[model samples]
Target: AIQIAASRDQLDPLLLSQAPGISFKYWKDATQLYLQQIDRLVAKGEDAKLAENKPYGGPVFRKMAVQLSLHDLKGAVTTLVDARLFQEAYVLSRTRYMDSLAEQTLRLWAHDCFLNGHYNTSSVCYMALGDLSQAAAALGKSSDEESLSLAADIAKVLGQTTFAGHIEEKREFIKSKKELLEKLDKQVEDQDLKDLPSRSELVIKENNTEKSQLEEPEKDTENAKEVASTDEKNLMSDTQAEESGKGEDENKIEKLLVELPEKMEGLLKDGIQNGMHKGDGDTMQNGEATDPQNNNEILAKPLQNGSEPVQEKSATE
Candidate 1:
């Protein structure tokens, strides 16, 4: 808890080892040594003189933190506001849930900054306080178009259309820029929506292709086995047919060898018969055929004719 308190803020240290009289440097122009008079008055319980030179000062921070711990939040916040440390004042006011007091202090801070010519800070304070009118008015008095355009949007939201229209007309370039940015944002959203479905479709197609590829290897393996089996059957049939053909050819050769001797003997017998017939043909040519009937006929025919007996002439003669 002590560390948390010590670490709550760098400027607003939650815990301080020194009191009002034992101050450290918080401002540049004045140091604790110069404010020793105020410390002496605070130590002596002289409350009136403690705020003599300055109503709220750097030397009183320790006392303020002490007062906050003691639940004197109202006094602490009031003292912080008088010290012109609105940030600290606002923090205490917000933490303590003093809504009315916070609102008052916020307006006061904006008003103070505006009077001090810190229009941008004043605009921011007004924005934080949700006073869009004051924020737009304050930004209009400054030179930043973007922040002014933002204030114009707040004004539009609050139904200050005239102010919004005037701001948009004054900063036409900024208006066009904002429109272009809005157009780009919408286009990006539409493109993203379109890509969503295409991405899913691509994933589905890739998965289908992968599944087919996985199944094709198995199919190819089966086809290869079938082709191999058929090739083996054809090879075996071809081998058997070749062996049978060789056996048939050998049988034909053996049968031809066995019949060749008989064929030659038959040829020899026919040749001897033909030679005998040819030898008989020489006698037949001399008109000396061995037929007795032919000889008788020839003699009778000569006797009956009662002429000279005709003699047969041999073909050789």
Candidate 2:
């Protein structure tokens, strides 16, 4: 009723003055008046204003009611957007408000000619609010590559690796484009597919270039194949030699293992026989040394008489 009366210019200031709390009388704005009533409701422990309540009614009524309670920031954002107060609308879109959803919307809207400044301002707001990812993204939209790089660096310092990486890539992409233009002396007039270095052609060039240089000794395809074949043959020969060396080492190890038992048994038999000879007190004792030839003859006589020791027999077996 008040709305209709006010719209028709039939509402009187004297009637509004009588209803101080119910009207926007002496209030800075309608939002302030609505918020005062909402505060009263909160003091009484009433609900329906907070975001979790999912307040009923359409966007218009809901927006007015939602801001009064300071919940569901998107309601205010939507309302401001509908009113075409894009600067204020974008200012409210942030991490504390709608998180990344608002950022995504602002990023898209920044492409507009009118709202482009708003996007840059929003970026400054985001940076002041310490959201480097959003700031870098906004700078990119404004084509400020250098500032974008700086924002990416700030994000890296703050340990936002994923956001920093994405921002850095955008900066690098712009940088590469600039470099390519400079290298071409700003002659971007080429339209032929063969002249342009497309991504697929680059991949093919890399794969094909790895094997042969542009200027090589062997130009003929058959000669190149033959050289490759020769190199392969050399590799095979080296491998075969290594295998043969390993086999020889195994055989030598086996031979040494077989001879070890025989050597031990022979030493044992010689010690026993020498002990028996010592017991006889025949020749070597005290300071006297036995003759090598006589010792050999004595040992040989026992073998010739078909009386070889068990140690010798086991060793042969």
Candidate 3:
């Protein structure tokens, strides 16, 4: 905190209590220091005589006044007005010089005091301070061309009618702003809602396509199972037919073997008789020679007699 000395005469009890809610710890410290200094100057011995000398009086008084002005920022306007009068008196008596920066600061504080809680004060301050646009902007009026035209037309109707007419007009302006914002919010909601259906539809379509794709494989698997079952049946039937044909062929072979022995017996009997007849008739030709007709008759005799041929006669032929 800054600490500067306040003059004893400038100290006022009511000023501290009447201060607004601004921070003024520096001023309180300065007041305490000034009181201590006064107490030191009035002390019993050597410092008392030194305090009466004019050597450092002017600078010290000026410093004390600056400290008083800093505190005055927290004071009421009435106290500030009294301080300004006091300052003017001191200047007139050539007791102290006013600092330009300090004077401007006091004026700014005075302006803040007057302007507190007043819109017109802000308007005037900004306007005089070469801030016309800011002054106009601070009024909270709409700058949009359409709103401005509407406000003007409203004002014109108010001029033609009663002064109170524009009160309702102002309410309408607020309501219109709210409605416009609501419409924009609803439009955004509608766009969001639109995107939802498309997203859901896409998801549904994809799910259906995937379901169809999965079902197709299942159907194909069923067809393949049926085909495999049919092929198995065909293979089993073919095997059964082959086994039956093998059994029939075996039976036919057994039947052929039984008939073959009987046929062979008839041929052997016919051959022996024919051989003897050939031997008697062909004796003149040669002992080993035989006629062709007699040879055939002898070969047939073995089968007719149903007996084995005689070994002696067979050897001679």
Top TM-score hit: 1
Which has the higher lDDT value, candidate number 1 or candidate number 2?
1
Model 1: residues with Cα > 4 Å off, grouped in runs? 4-57, 169-317
lDDT of 2 by residue, 1-317 (tens): 33443444333332233243344453334444445555665787753433243223445544544463455566667776666555566666763466575765554444342254654676766665566666666665554687777767767777877977887787788889988878786455443334668899999999789656753555687688999999999999999999999999999999887776666557756786776577446433444444455444544543322233342221111
TM-score of each: 0.35, 0.25, 0.25
RMSD of each: 18.9, 26.1, 18.2
As for model 3, its CA RMSD to the true structure in angstroms is: 18.2
**What is the Å distance of residue 66 in model 3 from its true position?**
63
Clashes of each: 0, 0, 16
Candidates sorted on lDDT, descending:
1, 2, 3
Clashing pairs in 1: none
**Error of model 3, residue 114, in angstroms:** 74
For candidate 2, the per-residue lDDT at 50 reads 31
Misplaced by over 4 Å in model 2 are: 1-80, 88-119, 128-130, 137-143, 162-166, 182-317
Question: What are the lDDT figures for the candidates, one per model?
Answer: 0.68, 0.59, 0.51
Best by lDDT: 1
